[model samples]
Target: MVDRTPCASTTAFAQMAGLDSKTPHPTSIVVHRQSRVLEIEFDQGSAFRLPFELLRVYSPSAEVRGHGPGQEVLQIGKRGVDIVALEPVGNYAVQPRFSDGHATGLYSWDYLYWLGVNQETLWNDYLKRLEAAGASRE
Candidate 1:
């Protein structure tokens, strides 16, 4: 198996990819809890708003998922979660410390962008599955 541990080389690669593997200079991050959206604004006026449900379901924590493929844990009861903090992870990603104490996920820029782009489809699919399972984000 390939080592997924973060190392010097990986750090370097993450930095080179414009992922800010260390610290990213974001002007602001706004969270609309009611709308379930988190907005990130950079110094260059480029910004994106991501859905809370999507972020929660795709959290990068072992509690939500294992370290390898096909180990993802289905998250539930996080529809109204909010972003409590945004901590920088070196210069590659941002550790979105959620109010639920889910601070282990390091959301890289690419991942965040992907989440924004696919929010609707992902959220809908999640909701559909939840409905099929008779589950709700409680």
Candidate 2:
């Protein structure tokens, strides 16, 4: 069974995240360079803090994920990647540029929530893949 979330369950933010269909959209999104964390908050009190490395590795770019089946590339050498810029893409998404010259992914509200929801499992899987491929986070 899929674990349905609360914050993204019945708000506009959730809807944007492709989550739910209620009011109270996202209120704020902040990026912290020193801590390498991106913080997002919804009007319904839903908030998440995402790491730069995770964001970089999980970027929603065709270059990283590819446009077909089994085309996902494993990103490496991004342990210290930071969000250098957060350019707004109209009113729906934000384009975050990484310090390592990665600036193609556009993160939507729903996408951010999805990442936060599955972060633990995704991070663990990334670690496993890194170990198997002998890739370093450095």
Q: Which one is best on lDDT?
A: 2
Question: Model 2: what TM-score?
Answer: 0.82
lDDT of 1 by residue, 19-101 (tens): 66333446776768677688977665567788776888888667777867888677778876888777777654678777777
Candidate 2: global Cα-lDDT? 0.84
TM-score of each: 0.69, 0.82
Q: Lowest lDDT 10-mer window, candidate 1?
A: 16-25
* Tens-digit per-residue lDDT, 1-138, candidate 2: 976765533565445544445433468988988899998888778888889999999998898899878999999999999999999876667899999999999887678777877989999999999999999999
Pairs that collide in candidate 2 are 17-110
Model 1 per-residue lDDT at 1: 100
- TM-score, candidate 1, is 0.69
